[model samples]
Target: DRYFPSSKLCSSCGSIKKDLKLKDRIYKCSCGLNINRDYNASINLSRYELAI
Candidate 1:
């Protein structure tokens, strides 16, 4: 989905980081989730479910 926030969304806590920039290579969540941005996005993509 075009609106799916794969990179900006925290995979651990499901919170969206609206200010995330392309330069940000690490995904840090307020819930203490610290991971690589690409890895985090991949994890989120793997768990994505289409809302049909």
Candidate 2:
């Protein structure tokens, strides 16, 4: 029962980009964090369990 929007969410500031698309390979955050999309998603997914 996991429904988190890990890819669209910023791993640094927790801000979400509603217009993010799958073709984007990089995740850029306004908080000066720019990282690979997969890495960002992985980090965000790891935080999901702790969020509960």
TM-score on alpha carbons, each prediction:
0.88, 0.85
lDDT for model 1: 0.92
Give per-model CA RMSD: 1.7, 1.3
lDDT, candidate 1, 1-47, per-residue tens: 87899999999989999999999999989999999999999888888
Q: For candidate 2, lDDT tens digit of each residue in 1-52? A: 3668899889999999888899999998889889999999899998897877
Whole-model Cα lDDT of every candidate shown, in order: 0.92, 0.89
Candidate 2 wrong stretches, greater than 4 Å: none
Residue pairs clashing in model 1 are: none
Give the 10-residue window scoring lowest on summed lDDT in candidate 2.
Answer: 1-10
How far residue 23's Cα lies from its native spot in candidate 1, in Å, is 0.2
